[model samples]
Target: MEYARRFPGGARAADLLLCLAITAPLLLPDHDGFAPTGLPLGWMRIAAAPLLALAVLISRRRPVAAAAVPAALGLAASPELHTAVGFAVAQVTLAFLLGHRAADRPPALWLFAGVLGAGGLALLAAPDADFEDGGTLVANVLLVFVLPWLAGQGMRQRAELDRAGWQLAERLERERHLVVHQARLRERARIATDMHDSLGHDLALIAVRAGGLKVAADTSPQGREAAEELRRSAAAAARRLHEVIQVLREGDETAPLRPAGESVAVLVHNAKASGIPVTLDDLLSDGDALPPMTERAIFRVVQEALTNAAKHAEGAPITVTMSRDGRNAVVTVTNDAPAVGTTPPVPPQNANGHGLIGLDERVRQAGGTLHAHPTAKGFTVTAHLPLSAGAPATPPRAASTTREHAATTRRTARRRALHTIGLPTAGITVLLLFMALNDHGTDSSLLEKHKYNELRIGESQQVVEDRLPARQLRPEHRPARPNGADECRYYGTDPDSFTPAYQLCFTAGRLSHKDKVVLSRVG
Candidate 1:
């Protein structure tokens, strides 16, 4: 029921409600007024209605079980059942649901095969009814049970294929959009990077020229003062340029946080110079022991963490800790609480979206993990990069492996179907053969009409023995004599049933009496 909720609409609840409502009428007398077979109509319907409802209840998650419940009960009850229309109806619905709702094919396929074998077993086991032959029973079972289930399975496969096709289309569409988006972001980052590097170098050169002018021997006091102001203004413009660049390159994963050759210690020192009260704790077997990618990832993690601290927990005492644990290089950047209340800073919308996303990407590419969360005091960012796991394992070839997996699944399903069908059918066949061979009746004992007419009243025992056939009958199949006699022998006109047989009595080695031919009980 819960899984069916994924199907859509308020009708999910209505399905069960309607099922139960229909079931409510099972408590009322069957309007057809047919004689109750064994249990009353209400009680008989009760046996199966709730089960079908339960089958519907669990059809989504346990489709195979839903199919099995009615199949098993119906097969077991087939012998006593003069008509299986009720069980057949339930079975057909459940079978279709089995196929339609099944998430996988093998289970339902095997179940269908098993139900078939169970039906065969029921054939051999059910007591023979004169009105119903084995052929008709088999036909009914296949039509109302197996065929409908198979139809449902067909629909299931078609629906699954349709779903798969749509999903593939959706994924392709998403991939196309992602590729376009990433291309645009890359082009923007390249522009941003070029602007930052070229413009930043020009501003630095201008600051240097102003400083030279400010300190030159030929320069006057007013001139030096003007040069000094110019230098400060140029420096401020450079800082503003950097801030603009940070926002411009917001989601750029490839964009560098700082210039190359700067170590984590240098970054910490720079943060300290910025007056953020930063501290560094480096405890490692060797500082430069990590691989290049992992080292780069570690740098980005610390860079992102420090940036967050500055933005969100400004003025907090920040601690940058580096250590080696097991095969992982652990780097943690945690900031103490801000001077404000324990409440963490609400990050600017733009800032919250990108920096940490880049950090996560960087860490994962290096075959590691990144975690950033707030603590009671403030916020923390931690990264664990493997020291010697090498690069992440190469992804398997999905196209080729998919085909191989499909082939393997098909093979397995075929094997299971054979086992499911073969075992029970074989058992039933052997038992049936055993029953046929063990039967003890023959035509030799049968009394034909001509033989019965050949008999004479008070015929000599020798003549009667010569005319008599050698059929044997069970005591229960023999007819009751009107008058008691010393010995009576029953003979069948046909070797199968007991009716239409002859009974002969003999006394003193002579035929004393001959009973008239009569219909008798079957053997």
Candidate 2:
């Protein structure tokens, strides 16, 4: 059944042949148009074959119904069908079809056994013309009925195994997707927690300091009102940020809080009001309408750059630039070095160096990149934010991608090596073993020359072996001369014999000459 799904065209052709085999016997003419029982096959009997074949064709989706109907009809018509070869073939084919198409094995096996028992009894009651004895009847039933059933059961088991393998693969793929999704959610929650805990505390302190300065006795009325507004806004922003972090922690789909559509122009104005000399070059007319997250990221980058410049390089002039290049919104901020011979302010020792790092993470989460580096004049920070919706925020590291590709290539090479080299090497070894086992020339007894006196030059190696008792010879230690002739040698058992060894030289399977070896030791 699995094979049919894999190759539909072939399965359809096979099904066509099965249906024809089952039905053709019904339409076939009996010998001389008469049954052996001297009974004519009426229309009813002839009609039964096609109906049974139709039932078997429908059995692919309904195996039980097909099996029962055909068995009942065949039994009613068994006496007339016993002499027809096609009837036996049809019965066997129906049994195989039923077993192969069964939805469950246990019930199918019981039904199959019952059908076999019924078929055996019917054959015993009305034996075929050729089967004059009970023994032949039983043999026919076993050969025709049981064997096909076993083959169909084998097919059913194989189909079930293939189905199980397919289901397992699908389950594993789903689990892999779920695991990756969970990892991304965890990373987002970690980022949210860090921003709320660290940056939110810093902003809260700024609000309190501004509130204290607003009520001082020396403050002017206009300045006091501005300070009061800044304090309230900062405090409200901090509270809203806490709510956003809580939503992220609970994995809610609610949108996080964002700044009130802040623009680069507003950020530049704030930096100048803070007493840091700054200039702006705005080349983007649509900068204010950027996506909420992208605009927030840009505003934060500018603010962090101005703050870093004011703290470390006071009195240095800073320049901010904004423009749209292709689909990216680009921003760069640079500050000049302090005047010559002017001492720069020293940074505090308690600084954790997380300002630039946090800014970089924010830009990346908005599907952008950030670069901060020192220049010959002073320092510069630049960022690029993508405008496309749903683009991946975090780009994969190049090193990791390369390593994954290398691993995949190694696995492919291993499989190729097994098919290209391992299979051929195994095939050659098997062939060599087959040749060695069947070769008569490898026999040890054929290498011995016991009757060397009867051997003569120009005789074939086969003739020499026949005349001499070729026994107790070693194939590995065969002698060879420089002129390229193969030699076989045998040592004499007698220690005092004048001729201690006999040697026979053969050139191209024909005996060429013989020699005697005399062993003598030099003292």
Candidate 3:
């Protein structure tokens, strides 16, 4: 079924074949018996039947127009010819096709109803017709036209329901994929937070402990120098580890750095204390007035730029600038080229080379932009952070909100399934029960009392009529020679039933033979 939906031309071709099947019967020689006779235009009217059948065949593409062709042709053909079974069948098929194939229902239904009214009037006025009475004609029209129209309507509703179900399933599938992807992202964020909080703190403590060991007086002079080198290296390694952890915590709820509003002057002072030749141009004297998130982003940006400059451009003079431009806080860090004989420091093993990438994400989360590139003399890093209070401090969706949205989507899908599937199933069940109760068959009580062995030979016809109603007898299974002196058979079972049935044969109005027979079941 999914494959067929992908290529709908195959289904349209099948519908075309069905239209041909319904129309081909009207073009046969049997339909010519009802053709007009003893008139100069009789042959033309006979030809119109085939032409109308051809029009019905063309209606598969244009249902509304095709439906009108047969109806108009039928009304123009002859009032006497309306009694023909082929004529009635053609109109019924056209009515069903109109409702089944029309893109819109209101117009199709109105057109069909108009055609039915015209055809019913013609059928009633038909000369010497089987349905001449007003009540009989109305009943006939209801059976032949209205019932088939209702069936077509049901088919249209079912098709619409199937399409809606397919669309809903597709939407739900996409939502499921989105929810799963969000969950994976949240898990990664959680892991990043844990690593930064535990591992980062431990690395900082290690650097502090190594610095204390270097200044202790109990150590020898050579050991003191070695401890000093260890302390310097450990401090460098700790700074590199912090950059890596910051990158890992890009999309996490909590910032990897201290959430307190740290001063940019303090960040610059620390870099100069680390033996780097640096200069600061502070434009915001009172930096504590800025939002905590904006200040944190600015501090991290300057810290990373200074660290990179110290490692890659040793002995280079660096400049740091901070200012407020309209609604934004702009920070730029630039360093001069290293001396000709200078060599860059070796990067630590723990570095993942994602420091700048993580910094960009952090700046973006704070509604800011960061740019880092090499100049003719040295490298420069610049960041612009929005000072607006409305700037978002995190990603669009949090873990809690994503889970709630997924749950809501699931509940909506369940409700849609119940309305679309459950309601239709219940309606069909009720219709089947109504049909069973109203079916033209022998009552259960009659079948229980009249088993095959109970009827004896030579019983009068009047005697059997007392036990079973005449309407319960199967006409097709009746005796072949009822007017002859030969035995006449009357089967006692429902016409549509497959159970073991009883047959009573009468000759000269008296029961002559009785037997049990198994009826053939229709598929």
Candidate 4:
């Protein structure tokens, strides 16, 4: 907005008026009245005001040039007056602006100092009727020159601080943008990995069939059948690849939906079509409603798991399971583990490292967990995704309610006896052990003792209890210490929760004088 752009205009205008006010007295005719001793103090008044006004007006636009003109005028008019006080102020302001504009202009400062010294000598040679003593002259010099120089120095320091703050804010914004960009790139790499794993085998099988068809273009019925199947499978694989590329290319939240009838079942069919053995459990009914994120997450996990299995398992049978209860969906994939000491196929040179890691991140971001490990009999990947909404409402539980009421009556006496004696003792033990072990050990200043003290405490305190309290033991007195020498260890914590537990550790030691540390964090 125009209003925002000109927000500082009023302040700048006020400064211009202040600059003019300082020189307003100079405009009065014959204001520089001479004393009875024939000494003119009024001449000093005449030159000081106008020079300051000129310097102030152009200070921002052309600071050095603005300051220089007034300084030159004052120096030329120096003999008539003992001091061009305005010129001294202008010179100091010029020096400050010059240093800030191009910080290495040292010679400019020295040159100004030499000129000041020469001017002071010339003033001392003049026949002056005032300021007789060295103390008086020095006091005058300090008031006229030193104060403005100091003011200019303070302004320059403030400007530098402002610039530093702006740079820091800009750097943080750039870092945030870079992190989002990297996440997007990692997503693309994951899609590529999945495509390579799933489609590569089908394409390779098609290539084999194509070779056979080319060799037996004559009357061979078996060869013709193989060639036709190869063409159909290749078309299907190409269609799936095109779908994935479309998703990657646009990256829009509202891009086109997947083609009708494309699903994990179709993917399994494709794998089987390529002559790989695969078994699938269709646990969810066709009528089940699913969130897009959950569906995409499920698809990626299965794709990656199956691809990895086919690549390394040497044609081992793959088992895929999908189950959806009212409020949760689970996917489990398992395949025979490779024989002992069998090396995995080295991923091609263009393979990105985001395959499994991306799948894990996607599942976690959707409030689920993905687990992958080598079982005794096979390799397995299992994911449990929570439903976005709670479970569907149950029908009116008239019969269930009557049965529950009868069960509750039968168990009331036993439940009462158990809680009356068992719960409090278990709660007390849990409280005591938690207070003793968790409080001091989790404190930032005392965290370094964790390896020894915490481990010992956990071993000593582990015990059986019938019931336990639901409340968490609070570490009330532990202070947060980030930059203290007494802090013994850093406790990595949940980034979302700012509270981090630390262990006892010393402050980071300083480097020796022989070592160098760059001031910039870039290093």
Q: Which candidate tops lDDT? A: 1
Give the alpha carbon lDDT tens digit for every residue of 1-523 in model 2. 6445545577676667677767766664432212333234465456666677677567778776766565555445443234342356666776676667764666656664665566556656653533443344455445555577668878888868856865675676666546545544544554576567656878899898889889899999998999899999889989998887887674442333234444678778877898889999887655546774576678778978988898878899999998999998899999999878778788654222456755776777889898999999999999998766555687623323334554586679779989999999999989976854323222322323445566778999888766653343343434444266776545442322313456667788988868765434211
Clashing pairs in 2: 448-470, 448-471
The local distance difference test score of each candidate is: 0.68, 0.65, 0.63, 0.54
- Which lDDT tens digits does candidate 4 get at residues 1-523? 1222345667466556556655653443331111112234366556556656666666556555554554455445552223323344444544454444433345445545544664566556756724443343354344444455456666667667855865675676666556645654666544454444446556767767776685775938887777777777786777677676655643432222233346888888898899778999978646467765667678778878888887878567899999986677999999996667777787654234445665676676556678889998889999887767333222221223333544575479558868886899889989976863443233222212223332321121212011111221133444344354443222323212224432322333421111111111100
Error of 3 at 320 (Å): 57
User: Candidate 2 — which residues are off by over 4 angstroms?
Assistant: 1-18, 25-45, 57-62, 68-84, 103-133, 164-175, 197-218, 246-364, 368-523
TM-score of each: 0.35, 0.41, 0.40, 0.36
The superposed Cα distance between candidate 1 and the true structure at residue 129, in angstroms, equals 4.2
In the range 455-523, model 1's lDDT, one tens digit per residue, is: 886787888988776544545545565464667877766545555667788877777777655654544
Q: After superposition, how far is residue 225 of candidate 3 from its true place, in Å?
A: 7.8
Candidate No. with top TM-score: 2
Q: lDDT tens string, model 3, 110-165?
A: 76567557656765666655554444445544555567666777887787886787
Error of 2 at 134 (Å): 3.1
- Give the winner by TM-score: 1 or 2: 2
